[model samples]
Target chain A: MSEKILIKGNEAIAEAAIAAGCRHFFGYPITPQSELAAYLARRMPKVGGVYLQAESEVAAINMVYGAAAAGVRCMTSSSSPGISLKSEGLSYLAGCDLPAVLINVQRGGPGLGGIQPSQADYFQATRGGGHGDYHIIVLAPGGVQEMYSYTRDAFDLADKHRMTVMVLTDGILGQMMEATATENGEQTADNRQEKPWAVGGVRGERARNIVNSLYLKPSELEATNLSRYEKYKQVEETEQKYDSYLLDDAEIVVAAYGASSRIAKNAIDEARSKGVKAGLLRPITLWPFPKKAFAAAAKKARAFVSVEMSMGQMIEDIELSIRCSRPVTLCNRVGGMVPDPAMICEAILNANKEATA
Target chain B: METRILIAGFGGQGILFMGKYLAYIGMSQDRQVSWLPSYGPEMRGGTAQCGVILSDTAIGSPLVEEPDILAAMNLPSFHAFEKSVKPGGTLYYDSAFVAAPGTRSDITYIAVSATQTAESNNLKGLANMVMAGALLKSLPGADGGVIETAMKKTVPERKREMFDANMKAVTLGRAL
Candidate 1:
């Protein structure tokens, strides 16, 4: 157990990464997420860790790939535009089956939109941000506490799956400050275990381990892709996580993730007070999509409203999860603006009206 | 019970710090607290504001569109946030810098010359603390002693001197 301290979300993520045995952090500074890099700069040195501010996001993520290939727990963080630059490296990491954590403290984007909170990176994160038929395990944390816990979970999951794990959070979650409890000391790294497949030249007996994504032969590439898909399926079976609130008799269920989910919870509570049976399904694991939870929730839900801090990205997933048995509506804000509880509550009311109408 | 407060002022006015202190006080009392600031290029001038939510239950959203209490330290902030305070909520503004306090019939408005008081008392940068003190006084459930103790933890060790000055400002503001 650790003492509770008031810390910012970005700083909490950095601290939790340290606790999770991550010693190398490479990142390029960007708006709404620079605090994460700054905190790592100050704390990594104190812990004798390597904290490098790379010249750009591309260089930083590649540095992460290099360190990860060396069998060390390494990470990189950036906002939307920066993460876009790191997409190539992220795809490479996924293809190489390298265990690394990438934190996306997201801001508004299609291009260089704005630097306020926005969950507009859903498709990019869940559907492989780079050019590949690959997927990164994306964890969406709704608050400061989840920011800490999810970051720590990211390391464990990355190592477990030998895949790139992303902590998908918006600018609000990154900048928000809250009371959080962190473990006292750092955990031991698992370099020795990773050494089996690590890129360090054959030590004595075992064959050399090559960490790369390039497959010259078509059959070899197909086999690699198939194996990755198999692992992703296994992940989908085991890693679905979500928080279900007031769903027992919920007629209208609001599906949301990360920051939008936080606001949706408030709307759910408000709607319930006014005799509206509104519930929430907050996806913690965005990549796994928590299909089972939604499948179960769909049994009781009459209508659904997908709340997001974007134009609407997760709504498609919600529609697919429920198989269009119930109508799925959208309640969203875009370009770095967060929707208020009142707006979301109205969306719930509209969903209910449509369901009854 | 929950208290959703908005503290707004210029960047140098310690608006973020004011929200932090309230959050720290809530944490000291073992309550759930969240403080979120508006950051980006818009933070050009000292035009910064933060939303602080202190709740007995889990806090759903850190964003408080309509705050139970709105504390403004400058005219821009006052003008920007006056209408956002909930009906029958409390609005506390620093009269030293803000020239006009809008007339809102539903909410109770308190205008304090916090900057002037801090200046007169030779406590130059304690204006935010004074406003914070007034905020604490308005909330009946908050404990002044807990806040003072939390202030010790929140203030950095190197800036130990400012803690005393802040406490002094808090004490004076509470009296107002």
Candidate 2:
């Protein structure tokens, strides 16, 4: 702890990005996540980093493409709709095997969705939104602190693996008030390691590093994807994190992520007061899915309830994880809605009652 | 036992900060606590609310529909969530902003002109903290001393002036 103060989640992420040595930022404004873009726009000029609000999401991603080709630490962010426009650029980034950070402060969407928070884009993020057999390091942050930590990690991991990394967050995590002033986040604006690959005047010192993904052979593309997948598996193995609350003697466990899990924790508290042995499993990494934790918890948990903002995206992961536990149940609110704790408590009570019966 | 609460008001009223203060004190007291809010455009000078739960057991949900208590700072919030308060639950409101804070006979409603009192104290921003002190007066198991300490935890060390004002506001608001 450096100095304690309260800061919104988006501003924290921006400060973290700057501390991580990412000097170039390109983005289009979108709701729920606009605070990040705005923060970058205001600060980047003072720090001598390039901050451009591109004409559209497409243009922002393309600018990222150009910067990353030069091997510079660069980034761009958008909401779900803007993320859709950048899909083509994402595929291009994957094909080229370049490193950059992309942020999706997801809002409800299949199309121009409302500006409230939702996790419907989980499929889009984990599966790689564009048409390709490629992969990107996907990180999910549930709160304000991770909003800062993950952005820094995304940059480090992207550079280390020489691949793209996306920070997947919801509107709440992007916009919520959180205590981050104690953390030394001012470093985000000042840290940038030298990248020989970045585009700048070479001054006859060495050959220019050309960035391209135009190899015509299918085998070449397949090899690139395989290498990327291998890197992803390593990330999953070492980088996965989830939080457990009062599960030691719990008979029923509820699984939720991001902002939804916090609500679930409240429900568990309520249910336990009423004599229901409920607990919560909060996944910090949505892509890795924390299958092992779910498997371990299933040893004592009679049943697991998979809760999310979207109906069933993470439910698929939960169902595949536990072998002997009661069938997983779902509690959700879609189209920019958050699930209520009362409903969660009811589900836990009902599930516990059914198990007893 | 679970103590789930919802605190709601306009943006400047410090409702969110009140929730944060409760959470901090709950944490210091070794209770399970979480603070959650309705963010984004709704956070812009309009009705802002936070759902907080302080429990002795593992927390299952963070959402507080039919919260055990409500701290409604303004009219819109009272109207939006009044029906959700549990029977026998306590409601603390600033009579200055909320003219008719729900007429439910089952719930205990404490109306205080907190904003007016805070303005009179020459600490308008303290209106939120004033109402917060009123909550300490009304709610069971809530202590004024503990809440004062909690307010210190919330105030940034750099904003020491804000602390005296907030404490004074709390005292002034409590008298109402």
Report the C-alpha lDDT of model 2 over B1-176, residue by residue, as the tens digit. Answer: 88888999888777788888777656555666666777757677777888887778755445577788898888888888888899999888878877764779999888877878878778867777777777766444566467666677788667989877877877776666
Candidate that scores best on lDDT: 1
- In model 2, the runs with Cα more than 4 Å from the true position are A46-48, A186-200, A247-251, A270-279, A295-302, A322-326, A349-357, B1-5, B9-37, B40-62, B67-69, B97-102, B118-133, B136-171
Error of 1 at A82 (Å): 1.0
Assess the local accuracy of residue A65 in candidate 2 as a C-alpha lDDT between 0 and 100.
95
Candidate 1 lDDT score at position A222? 97
RMSD of 1: 1.6
Model 1 CA deviation exceeding 4 Å by range: A187-193, A201-206
* Clash number by candidate, in order: 2, 23
Candidate 1, A224-285: lDDT as tens digits: 99999999999999999998788788999999988888889999999999889998888999
Q: State each candidate's chain A TM-score.
A: 0.97, 0.92
On a 0 to 100 scale, what is the lDDT of residue A162 in model 2? 73
TM-score of each: 0.97, 0.82
